[model samples]
Target: MSYQLQDLLYLMQRLRSPEGGCPWDRAQNFASIVPHTLEEVYEVVDAIEREDWGHLKGELGDLFFQVIFYAQLAQEEGRFDFHDILDALVVKLLRRHPHVFPNAELYQSLEAAPPVSMEEVGQLWEAIKHTERAEEAPHQPTRHLADIPTSLPGLTRARKLQKRAAQVGFDWPDPSGVLDKIEEEIQELRAAIASGRQAEIQDEMGDLLFAQVNLCRHLKVDPEQALRSTNRKFERRFDFIEQQVQSAGGDWTRFSLQALDAWWRAAKEQEKKHE
Candidate 1:
């Protein structure tokens, strides 16, 4: 396909048109297509992990389709079409990267402009978001860290909320301090449990996880990303175990706990050898 950036919006519209196009595409709405978008995102990550360019190419196309698919649906409903969406983003990109875009203060190299610190970059990004939203609709001036969507998965949202708050000096000074706070929260939870206070226990549990996420954030580690990577590693290791069991003429379900443990050890050893 001879796809160009300027023609992309028109392409998405044609894809969803009822006259002659994809039936699955024609039936989808923004709400109904959300899960597919999310699934495509994971597929992209999987491709990255596997280090397969061909896989990445396919997965990225799938992800790109999700965006276009949503935009097409919006056009069908008389909402802003894909071009409006693209134009808004293009404007935002130019506005945000003042260092790179012409008409802003020039740097020695394009890479060396402003936002010297990570915090400064974050401030600049948020400031642009606030400005854009205000222009779109007034009364959204106060952009709080916890304003992130509640519909996001709790663990993912927790990490994001903690990082957002920390960007504004609302965090422990060091990892050790966060570690100590985690223990304190745990102790408080225990006391709450002893007192039969369900609410207090639930609140303290959140505090504990938030503290841990803060430490992860400060250490330059994304807790959600770390967990997802480990989950992927575990899945690969377990799949290896399954393959090993099958090669030995053994059914995975028929294997005893000891047998599984032995296979797991072998997998670990193989991983270590590769390292």
Candidate 2:
């Protein structure tokens, strides 16, 4: 018989049980499992980006297991469990999609619901999210940027911060303005390098990267994905250079810069041919 979500939940419970439980699973806490959850997330992303459909199912299963593990931990602590998680998620989605669920009822017929423009839907989603954020912190002032997680990757976090600020009219008017800001940041970085103070240089470098992320946002590009693509390209070209060196029976130290440059040019040509 095919196993279902209930079976998966049972498996997690067994693994975390004190008696006859997997030692590694039993030892893990919320904080200890965070790294594995992050790795699983990236693996899922990698599989999708590579279009590895055969492995995508397995990667997604691994990511889902991380969620199950977290729920198991919370269940043991007398907190919410997997069912609660599902309930909250479904409720949130129904609440957010007012256009589809006009009566705010999940089981209600959608036949009579009015169609919504994509632009209006986007605005409505943001407005709902802002209201939810305010409700979450009713006693205190609502800081627009307060809810963004600090644990996000630098480029991803920078893009989110920029988007939040833009909602409040605190953003560059156009991509050209962002380009000018990037150029200004680069000049500041150059001056910092000339000063030779480590702290100043580091700060300037951060400013330069933040400006680049802003430029990417203004250009409708994902800075993280763009950098990942470049990284893969670099790896492919370097691998070609290594293969060329091995074919020539030459050591890396013996190869001059000019030889490596020629190999790099050859790699570019090969990539163009494939394209």
Candidate topping TM-score: 2
Q: Write the per-residue lDDT of candidate 1 for residues 139-240, one digit (tens) a residue.
A: 455565535788777777887887677667887788898888888988988888898888888888888887777778778887777888899779878988
lDDT against the true structure, each candidate: 0.78, 0.93
Off by over 4 Å in 2: none
TM-score of candidate 2 against the unseen true structure: 0.97
Tell me the lDDT of model 1 at 241: 84
Report the C-alpha lDDT of model 2 over 18-70, residue by residue, as the tens digit: 89999999999999999999999999999998999999999999999999999
Deviation in Å, model 1, residue 7 alpha carbon: 6.2
Clashing pairs in 2: none
lDDT for predicted candidate 2 compared with the true structure: 0.93
